[model samples]
Target chain A: MSVLRKIWTALRGSARELGDAVVDANSIRIFEQEIRDAQAAIDDSKRALTGVMADKMKIDRRLAELNDLIADDEASAVKALEQDNEALALEVAQRIAKREAERKEQFEIAERLASQIASLRQKIDAAEKIIADHQRELSIVRTTESVQKATVQIVDNIAAQDSTLSSARSSLERIKARQQRLDDRLAAGEVLARESGEQALDEKLKAAGIKGEAADANAILARLRARAES
Target chain B: MSLLQDMTLSLANTVFEGHRFDCLPISGEQEVLQVQVSGLEEMPIYVTVTDTQILCISYLFKKSELKEGSINELNALLLELSLPMPLSSFGMVGDRYVIYGALALTATAEHVMKELTTLASNAVDALQTLEPYLK
Candidate 1:
């Protein structure tokens, strides 16, 4: 059966049970098996491709030898005709024709082997892509299982501790409350800092004899003292 | 050690996007890293690493938390809004509705950090948007 059909069956089974751990586990197992099978098939194809390449190489060598033989025979036939030896030239021509036929046959075999190798490579690439896709989907399924299980523990912990993570509404309320508190704290801090900032500025001005009633009184006292000294 | 366990140790001292994470290892069949980002303590994102990918998930709400008649509407709305939500999507793991994001295993630490931050913030936004649907 197809991988998609298997996935569909698994999904339907899971939905029927609504969170059945067994079905989830089985689906994961099936995906793992599928990936393994694809990898094995790719390995086999690679081996077969090696064999096809070897055969093509053998055919190529034979074709090269036949071409050389055909060339030598044609040269001999031409030499015989130049010498006015008709029967010898005809015999040499027949030998060249035989070599040509053998080369043609070998060439056709090499072409078939080349095409077979190409198709095998394409099949390997497609199988590799399918394995990759299946691995990703399996990863997602496993991650979901881990996440749900982890959250189950968290839920149990929440129930045990009786904390605020029981529901979304309560958690949101707590989050809002925390935010509100932080905002209030910031606002209060700003007010206090502003008040103290003003006080510090007042003290600095008085000390500098710049802009305060205390500074005016000090100026009057200084003037009286200076006048007395003069 | 698994990749996530190594990350759990490294991320303890690491801060991303001005937010620090407190990585708590949840021991189970598959070790899950429950990373609680600073300032968003309530919405912790779970990190699980497989050979192929690193997945980050944050629980938005549970099935029981949805209003009696709002599950279908909420699911449809979530599907529509998921497209516009940057770098994250909504899904369900068992009874809990979650917002999640995924990254390749070969992703850099910076990439993982960015994914974690985005997933955490996305969960908060999704929860707030889904407030009307909750009980």
Candidate 2:
């Protein structure tokens, strides 16, 4: 079966809950095992390919030897016929025919072995691709697990600290509060400085025997309008 | 040496694109690099490099943080959001939701840094976008 199908099967079998650590761990193990199996299958195919290649080479050598023998025998037969020796010529012709037949047989074996090697090589290439895919998937699974586990540690560490790391909402509120505090301090400082200045001005007015009332914006505007009318 | 340890050492002195990284190794069965990026210090990116690929993850929130009855709605919304988001995807690691990106093992340090930056910023964006669904 394909690695994807195996993973799908495993996933289907364990899709009952989110964050099922056990199932995820088991799936990761299965994926690793599947990758190893694929590598082994590729190795087996390579070994088979080498064996067939060796056989093809052997047959190729035999075919070459047979060709040489056929050529020599044909030449000998020609020489025998030239010398008017019919029996010797016939014998050499028969030997050449036998060598030709052997060559044909060896050539056929070599062709078969070559085809076998080609298919094996193709299979190994495909298997290698599958293994790479499996490895990629396996790493994702393993890394997710690591990240999750590490997060647990990190979160625990953070929680152990006194509000060092908090929720996003809390962090946002904290930032807002920080800015708000700065604004409040500035406003308060301005109000205090104005109050002290007003108090000193009121004391000076009392020393000069003049009573001062706090001026309102609307009252000042009414006075200005009255003066314009007059 | 482990790849995580090597990366930790190299990243210790790395200041990329105006952000400095502080790498810490999370102790466990497997090595995980917790990279705290400057400015986005709240969201740390977790990195693990395998033989085939490099995986970087930043936790957005936990399942417990979701408002009551918003799980399905949030999940659907996350699925829709994943398509338009570049270089990152949303996933759940156990109970925690994370934004993660993956790269080939041949990816350069610059690529890793880019991924980390994108992942960290994406995480903060995800939290803000999903705030309505959070309690």
Candidate 3:
């Protein structure tokens, strides 16, 4: 195949792989965004829980102050009753008893609020853990995406280098072919002329009283011996 | 003026008269011409010519080894022509032809050397008129 064709094919494959990697990376980004949103929600819930706990503490302090006021009024009621002020003493006792009941109810409500705050805090902690785990997962996905991008880039670079090398090799081959054709044409004529000259010289040597036949006979005998041994 | 057109007429005359090589004027890139000198057989010497340079780009001959005499002769011709000889491992740069001495000499020492010298002399004469421009 041609170099251009090969390069095109390689590029198509690389693009396909890169497309898949992009999709995976985008999916990871979506997961990452979701985790971030969840973490934000967890943070908001934690802030609300802090407010609930503070409110519960405030209610408990109010209940304690009401109990202290009930105690002081009750002591004053007992002294008034001992001084024979029955009506005043009765009114003070009734007020103290009413305040005590209110304090007890407030303490119960505060306990319930504290319980709700604990439950909400547990939910926030669980959500945070999930977000943290998702964040870790997102990081892995990002790392994978980075590696994939590098792989694609490396493949592209290799393909480019290969194409350049192939083009250089093809050019060199064409040059060599042209040189060979010229060399063959020039050498063929010279070789023929040399062969004829050699033949003529052999003929002259034969006519000049040189024993060429004797040398040929010896050469034939040597070839026969070598062949027989093989 | 472009180097190719400026030297076309002189280059044609020199190639035909001095070297007995055929000249064909080229049009694109520059006013260059291609010259072909017929050797012993159908093998022809190929060269490219312009006003500033005459290049023996290709030749035909065969030998396993190159001689030192041919190398020295090529260097001398390059000096006379005021052209840089191509390094063996380098490629062409612009209008200059890159060649390796080892490869040229190995292929055909006598023929390569002779053609190189003739081309070099022709180039020197053609570009001599432009010496003041160079300085």
- Each prediction's TM-score versus the true structure: 0.79, 0.67, 0.36
Better of 1 and 2 by TM-score: 1
Superior candidate under DockQ, 1 versus 2: 1
Instruction: Please give the lDDT score for candidate 3.
Output: 0.51
* Ranking, DockQ, top scorer first: 1, 2, 3
Lowest lDDT sum, 10 consecutive residues, model 3 chain B, at B57-66
What residue runs in model 3 are displaced by over 4 Å at the alpha carbon? A1-26, A81-85, A154-230, B1-135
Clashing pairs in 1: none
Whose lDDT is higher: candidate 1's or candidate 2's?
1
Score candidate 2 by DockQ.
0.27
Q: Any residue pairs clashing in model 3, and if so which? A: B61-B107
lDDT of 3 by residue, A147-175 (tens): 33433343344335543112223333444
What is the lDDT, from 0 to 100, of the residue A195 in candidate 1? 100
lDDT of 1 by residue, A167-198 (tens): 78766876787789999999999999999999
Question: What docking class should model 3 receive?
Answer: incorrect
DockQ of 3: 0.01
